[model samples]
Target: MKLETLSVRIGRDVEPMAGDVAPAIHMSTTFERDSDGEFSRGYSYARADNPGRKALEQCIAALEGGHDATAYSSGSAASLAVFSLLRPGDHVVAPIESYHGTAKQLRDIIGPMGVQYTFVDMTRADAVRAALTPATKLVWIETPSNPMLNVSDIEAITALSHERGAIVCCDNTFATPVWQRPLRFGVDLVMHSSTKYFGGHSDVMGGAIVTREGGTLSERLRDYQGTAGNTPAAFDCWLLRRSLTTLVCRVRAQTENAARIAEFLSTHQGIERVFYPGLASHRGHDIARKQMQGGFGAMLSFCVRGGREEAFAVAGKMKYFTRATSLGGVESLVEHRASIEGPHTVTPQNLLRLSVGLEHADDLIADLDQALASRS
Candidate 1:
């Protein structure tokens, strides 16, 4: 079955709960073996495995149209598991404007671990090709790239990388499973900071990895997920699992709110630019439209007529849209990106990124209107 159809129907098929009713929380740290010092099922323990985590993983794997999935403590943990696949002296190529934490991981952390990397502007597929080397083990992609909203052409980069026997890893955080599924684009792996959209409520901090087939890749990742000792707690796993039930609905609503807000901001008197893939004015709008389902995601950014001072006042003045950093929650969040990163960071001073929420569109618009008017 297709992922969209399966996302709504996958976890319900299992008889894990009584008579196929709502699933209960299994907070077990360990499980008993049947006999002969051998266990008889797919799970053994909470650290290595848990029934709750398994349910979520299976559902997520089905959503990504992959054979297997593993859940982690955070998106960073999931990414670290993929990075461990690279050996010392291996080469990695990633987008220059990808997530900042991911960039730090490659340059400051993994690079010191003897891994070499080249940060190229991913909007240029040719640049990715030019950076390729025999040691290139992976190409990391972040579509609708962070902060600035630049998108990469996954089909072109993934196809080129595959020819050289390198894996393609896409961080599908910005475009949730609801909007984009990278596996369909021939990506080798799909991962999510499930903490964002999958959890849907911003209450759980977890990550997940999905692969096309369940084999060595699955086993290797599971081994790392276990060894790293960063697996999500049973409670967190259960929370995330519960969040899955409303994933589609919440994302759809948030996307709708985002589209309305983006449209308003696009031609607003005091706004200079809006960076939403949903907008036809966006450079990535066509590619995002071609590859994505439904709406382009709830996250977006817009620059004010003035720089940092004006952006800060705009962010500070919002009443309904709370000024916060993390996104993908039931409530709206607004942030001054450049302030969060300080002086040395890449986020521009004039930019304000928003995580649109389920609030009434008029209220959100009111908040924005007052905030922008205050700046004017």
Candidate 2:
């Protein structure tokens, strides 16, 4: 089945109950043992597994063309699970322009745990290759990267990492499986915040990790999740499954609106620069075009003409776009990323990140137009 069809039908079947169209949320934390001393239904405890989370995992695995998936409490938790697969002294190479949370986790949390990481400009394949060492166990790739929209060549980087006997993991939050499936490009693992796009609305918080071949590494991640008890609640899993049904439709509309807005910003006099993969003028346009399907993405960043104050002014003046963080929602959002990322942020002070939504393209453009005009 196609992605659109799979999204709605993958986990909809509920057996031995009423013929309800939607899947039921199995919120029971523990399952009863039958006969002697075994759980015949394959569920013993919530920490190990839940019916709703299992359904979600199957659906996501199908979408990403992976063998299996493990859902987590948050995207960061999902990332940490992968890091947990490594021991002390294991090294990782990641993009310098990654989501600040992921960077912080690698620097502050994982680093102290004895895992070493090197931040590199992933857009340059050479830089990624150069960052690898004998101890490098993983290479993290984030295409159409956060706050900057820099697209990296996934296949090229994956090949480089494979040659050095390292696993390559791609953060597909920005370009969901609907746009780009990294497993097909030889990525060992694909990670998603799920809270952003998979949840569709800004309500639920969840994360997922899908493994291409379901090997020992996948088993280790499952072990970490079950042991650490970082699994999502039954209700959250059900909500995410509900959101998956409309994933393709929402993303297509959001991407369309973003393309229009990026074009408008590129031509506007008050804008210094626009960072969107869809834009032909963007540095990664060709690479993004080659890899991404349908549309570039709904996320984009633009620099205000003056500086931080001018950027904040534009964000503050927006009427339709909410002045908040987080993306892949029904409602639009605009944020001065540097302010949110703090002192260690590499995001330009003059740049504002926009999470385009399902609003009318013209309305979004008009809001941006007026916002920029206010600064003039």
Candidate 3:
């Protein structure tokens, strides 16, 4: 089946007893055992496994063409689980311009746990190759990277990492499986903040990790999840599965809106640069074109003509786009990237990241036009 068909049909089946089209939420924390003392139903504890979460994990794993997957309470916990796979002295090579939270987790959390890391410009294959060491256990890729929209060549990076015995994991939140599938490009693992795209709305919080070959890594993640009890609640998992049904439709409309808005920003006198992989002028356009199927992405970032204060003025003037943080929601959002990342951030002072939503393209373009005009 095509992705559109799989999106709606993968995790859903008619309930046996209820005969309901939509699956019911399995909220039970424990399941009954047989008189002979066995869990014949394949689940025994909520923390270890739940019907709702199992459905979601199966859905995402199939979407990404992976062998298996595990759901988490949040994207952070899922991320931590991957890092937890490494012991003290394990090294990681990561993009210099990734989501701030990922970088922070490595620096503040994983670093103290005795792991070593090197931040490199992932767009440059040479830079990534130069950073690898004998100790490197993982290579982290985040293409159409947060705030910068830098695209990494997944096939190239994967080959480089694999040659050196490193596991390649990608943060696929920005470019969901609808746009790109890292496992197909030789990535060992694929991760998502199901809180964003999978939920399709801003209402739920969850994360997931899918494995390409389903070996020790997949088993380790499952073990860590059960032992640590960091998996999402039953209701959240059920909601995520429900939201997956419309993922394709919502992402397509939002990507169209983003392309239009990006083009408008590119030509505006008040804007300095628009960071969108779809635009021919972007540095990573060629690679993104090859890796991303239907569109670049709904998220983009632009720099104002002047400095931070001027950028804030344009954001404050926007009528349709809300001045806020987080992305992959039903409503559009604009945020001053540097401020949100804090004083130690490397993001430019003038950059504003936009999460284009399901609004009509003309309306979003007009709102941006007026907001840019306000700066003049």
Candidate 4:
């Protein structure tokens, strides 16, 4: 089935008894036991299993073309679950230009646990290959990387990782399944902050990991999820499942809006540079063209003509885009990348990240024009 059709159809079965089109949100923490002392319904507890989470996991797995999926309370938990599978003395390779939270997890949390990691420029396949040690068991890829919009060649990275006997996992949060499917490029796992596009709104928070094929790795993920007890609540799962019906439509629209906005900023005098893969001048445009389908993506970032203060002035004057953290929502958002990342941030002081939304391209452009206009 086409992605759009699948998005709406995946979990839309009518309730057998209620005769309702919308699937019922299974909220019971525990299920009934059979006379034989077995949980024949296939669910003994909410932490172990829930109908809502199962439906969500099934929907995301199908969408990503994966064999199975595990849902988590947040994207961090989903990522941590992957790291948990590795033992002490294991090594991981991750992108230097990635979400700060992921870096923090590696440096402060995972590293101290005795699992070492090396942060390299994932945009360069050779760099990644050189960084891998015999102990490396995982290669993490975050294409269209957070704040920077850097794109990595998934097929190349996956090949290198597999050659080294390392599992490759790509964070598909920025590039939703609608545009890119990492599993298609031989990535072992695909991860998402379903809290972003999957939820389609700021109302819900959740995460998910979809495996290319079920085996020892997938089984371990399931065990860790149940034992950690950090799976999404029943309502969050239901909300995310309902939101999936519109995933394709919403992401495409937001992508179009972003392309237009990127174009406008690229030529504007107040902009030092626009970081969008859709632009031909962008460093990763060719790789993105080869990998992404439908459109580039909804997220873009640009540098102000001056420094941090100038960027702050531009953000302050914005009339439409909200100055906020987080992305992948219906409402446009603007954020000063470095300020939010704190003192250790490698992000350029002049860079401002924008999360384009479902708003009309023209209105968003005009608002940006006025915001960047001369104040004298």
- Weakest 10 consecutive residues of candidate 2 by summed lDDT: 11-20
Q: Against the true structure, what is each candidate's TM-score?
A: 0.95, 0.99, 0.98, 0.99
TM value for model 3: 0.98
Residue-wise C-alpha lDDT for candidate 2, range 213-321, written one tens digit per residue: 9679889889999999999999999999999999999999999999999999999989889999999899999999889986898999999999998888888889999
Global lDDT of model 4: 0.93
By lDDT, who's the top model here?
4
- Tell me the alpha-carbon RMSD of every candidate: 1.7, 0.9, 0.9, 1.0
List, residue by residue over 1-376, the lDDT tens digit for candidate 4: 9899889888777888979898898989999999999998899999999988998998999999999999999999999999998899999999988899888899889999999999999999999999999999999999999999999999999999999999999999999999999999999999999989999888999999999998998999999999999999999999999999999999999999999999999999888899999999999999999999858999999999989999999999998899998899999999998987765588999999999999899999999999999721
Residue ranges of candidate 3 with Cα displaced over 4 Å: none
lDDT of every predicted structure (CA atoms): 0.86, 0.93, 0.92, 0.93
State the RMSD for candidate 4.
1.0
lDDT of 4 at 11: 71
Model 2 regions more than 4 Å off: none
What stretches of model 4 exceed 4 Å from their correct place? none
lDDT order, best first, reads 4, 2, 3, 1
Residue pairs in clash, model 2: none
The residue-by-residue lDDT of candidate 1 on 166-281, one tens digit each, is 99999998888888889999997888998888887868899999998778888899898888888999888878877887888888999999999999999898998999989998
Candidate 1: misplaced stretches above 4 Å? Answer: 1-5, 13-20, 342-344
- Which of 1 and 4 is the better model by lDDT? 4
**Between the candidate structures 2 and 3, which one is better when assessed by lDDT?**
2
